[model samples]
Target: MRQVLFLTKIFLKNLFRQPSIVFSSIILPLVVLWSTWWVTADLPMTFELANAEQDVSSSMIDVHVVTGSLTAMAITAGLFGFIITNEYRKISDRLELVGYSPTTTGFAIFLSLFVTLSFSIVITVFLANFLAAPKDPLGLTLAIVLVSLIYVSLGNLVAIIIPKATEGTLILLIVAFIDLMVLTNPMGGGVYLESWTYYLPGFWPIQVALEASFLGNASVSTMVYPLIYFVLTVILILFVRNARARSTMSFLSGGN
Candidate 1:
């Protein structure tokens, strides 16, 4: 427990010392959220129907717009692929040589990064709600947190595989584009299959938020999928850390 706390402290200290990293992780999200709200402030709430006689209500339309905006911002900020990749490049060898177990080190790094993500999301949501006053404030807040966690996990996984910072940033940009342009589009012209969007990690949070805002409270079942995704991410990260440790030990033992 003490070791974990020590590692966590060390990770945070190192994280905050880097001005660019701190700005990107914390300030970037707020900027994106504010810009979105500003640009969309004049838009009126209206929804189209394919063949139905009735149009969706203004409340529903507003909800859809807000949820979509939040999801996009969350994905952009929470996807810290470049940040983690840079950290690994700068410190992976030093960490390995310092006698710190890879699993412990990875967990500490993840936890510290998660804190920054959480802070950014929460602050942005607070500002958005305070200014515009979301109809379903509680639901929007919950959705923001869930979406942030899901994308952060995805970003972390990307970092593990992408060796270069530029490559990782490009990968995250592509992912964010796919998520927003393809998966989250309700117009049905996205790249993903119609049914496959439901399986995507960010889908449910956006869905639940829109439902709650536009159509009263959302179903409780909406929470289940993101939780499962979160658990699966943690497990996968642990496995990756353990695997890396084993490979390192083998190389050292073989004198290579």
Candidate 2:
């Protein structure tokens, strides 16, 4: 436990040392959220999703703004997860060489990200309430957090597999823009999303956020689906990381 704590402290210290990262993790979300809110403030529109199940749709346009902002926030969370894992890969190897367990190091790195994400969540929800308050703030917050967790796990897995920062970032940005900004964005053509979009990572979270914003509640299935997806993603990440490590070790030993 102490070893994990010590590593967590170091990770956080190093994380805050980078001004660009700090800006992205904190200021960037605010900028995106505010910009979204500004553009839609005058629209005063409502949307009923195709094949709708609920009457309380995104009516105020504020709900749309909130959902968009939350998407941006989730994207940033994922980016942070990718960066921390990528930047600290060398240090993680060194720690393992010094007798630190991989599990402990991994947990510490996640802990640092969780701390930063928690702060981002609070800031996002607080600002959204002032600009576009949800009908059920608590539920919206949960929905947002779930989305962020899913993306962060994804980001971590991508970093492990790709190992190239620029390429990984490009992939993340492409997915985020397509899934959240285009497909799930009620203000745009999201109402006509194809059935296949249901499988996208951003789908359920936006549904839940819309429910919370306009209806004051979300369905059991809506909430549970994201959790299930998160668990599956995490399992895949662990499996991939372990397989990669084993492959590296085998190659180092010349396939002996």
Candidate 3:
């Protein structure tokens, strides 16, 4: 336990040391979205989602815009998860050399992600609430944080499978673009409400956020689905990453 804690502390320090990541992942993305949201206050969009239809008002627009911003943040967090884990491959090997088991190191990596997501959800929700507080603050924030897990796990999966940074990021970008369309549907196509859309990880949180911020009448399914998806996704990614780590450790031991 102490070993895991020590490694997690070091991992966090390295993760936050990147100024560009801080700006790109957290600061710059939110700022641009908020600015656009401010400019479009008068031009509010009335979206007829799967469950609720938003009315045209500054508050309604704020909720819609902030929800979209949260989507962008989730995507960013996931990509950073990819970059951070990929960057640490060498250090992970060194830790193994020093007798830190794969399980210990793996927990540390996930602990860092948990910390990142917690801070991210808090700050972004605080900012969104400043524009207009959701009727159910607790539920909205929890849903946002929970949904981010999907992207984070996706990133970890990508890092394990794809060795090239360029390829991994491009893949995440394309996948996130599709998910964003499902969540926002700025085209007014209403295609997102189709049966196929509910299968998406983005759908659950987006639906829950819509209900919490606008109608305040989310179904039980909305609250439950994201939890199931997030847990399953995280569990699957951990097993895959750990298995890969063990394979790599074995190879390293053989070489020594």
Query: Which candidate number maximizes lDDT?
Result: 2
Collision pairs in model 3: none
Colliding pairs, model 2 = none
Kindly report the root-mean-square deviation of model 3 from the true structure over all alpha carbons.
3.3
- Ranking of candidates on lDDT, top first: 2, 3, 1
> Which candidate, 1 or 2, has the higher TM-score?
2
Model 3 per-residue lDDT at 121:
63
| Regions of model 1 farther than 4 Å from truth | 41-56, 59-65, 89-93, 96-98, 187-193
Residues 1-256, model 3: lDDT tens digits: 9999999999888777877766756675577457746765555455555655454233446655646655666677678778877887778768877878766776788788667666666667777666656776666776677667778777877877786899999988777767764434433246757788788777777777767766655667678888898788777776876787778777877944
Model 3 scores worst on lDDT over the 10 consecutive residues at 181-190
Model 2 / residue 29 / CA error / Å: 0.4
Compared with the true structure, what per-residue lDDT tens digits does model 1 show for residues 1-256? Answer: 5666787787778777887765676677666666655655443455432222344455433443465556555565545644664576447546766777777677777777777666677676776566546667787777777777777777777777665677777777777656654575442244433566777766677665655555556567776777788789878977876786677778878945
73 in model 1: Cα distance from truth in Å? 4.3
After the best TM-score superposition of candidate 3, give how far the Cα of residue 168 lies from its true spot, in angstroms. 1.5
Write model 2 residue lDDT over 1-256, tens digit each, in one string: 9999999999988888887865877787888888778776454565654334655444445865777766777789888889889998888767865767666777787778888778787878787777777888887888779888888888888888888999999898788877887777665574435777778888888888877777777777788888999989877876776666567566767987
The whole-model lDDT of each prediction reads 0.64, 0.77, 0.70
- Better-scoring candidate (TM-score), 2 or 3: 2
Each model's Cα RMSD:
4.0, 2.3, 3.3
